[model samples]
Target: MTVVFAALAVSRHLQDATGVSIQNLVRTLRTVRSATIRLGRHEITLALDIPAAAQAILDRLPPRGH
Candidate 1:
């Protein structure tokens, strides 16, 4: 699924069709942030680490300035 997302992220046709910049997709994938909330007297939070699948996709990408 991460590979599929990465492929879609880099697809010019998809970008043109959706008007979504690849930069934004890559940014979104790279920085999947955690969330926090408070309810009544309790606090709840979610901490997310980059999925191994996503990391693999990212690792295969060419470095910037390539």
Candidate 2:
């Protein structure tokens, strides 16, 4: 759900609502690493250092429709 994160990363309300943790988001901001993470019609190119757990969740998400 890279798209979701890209959105959530900007939303203070959403960040509070979901309680989703992105240590990667923090790391990326600090270290300036760049990578591409895509979902559905979205392609996000950010320097976010995604944690293993978040990466796993992204990997496990089903594409579009079953």
Model 2 Cα lDDT, one tens digit per residue, 39-66: 9999988766756655654454346544
Least lDDT summed over 10 consecutive residues: which range in candidate 1?
Answer: 12-21
Lowest summed lDDT across 10 adjacent residues in model 2 is found at 12-21
Top TM-score model: 1
lDDT of 1 at 24: 55
Please report, in order, the local distance difference test score of every candidate based on alpha carbons: 0.65, 0.55
Residue 3 miss distance in model 1 (angstroms) = 23
**CA RMSD (A), model 1:** 10.7
Note the clash tally of each candidate: 0, 2
lDDT of 2 at 42: 98
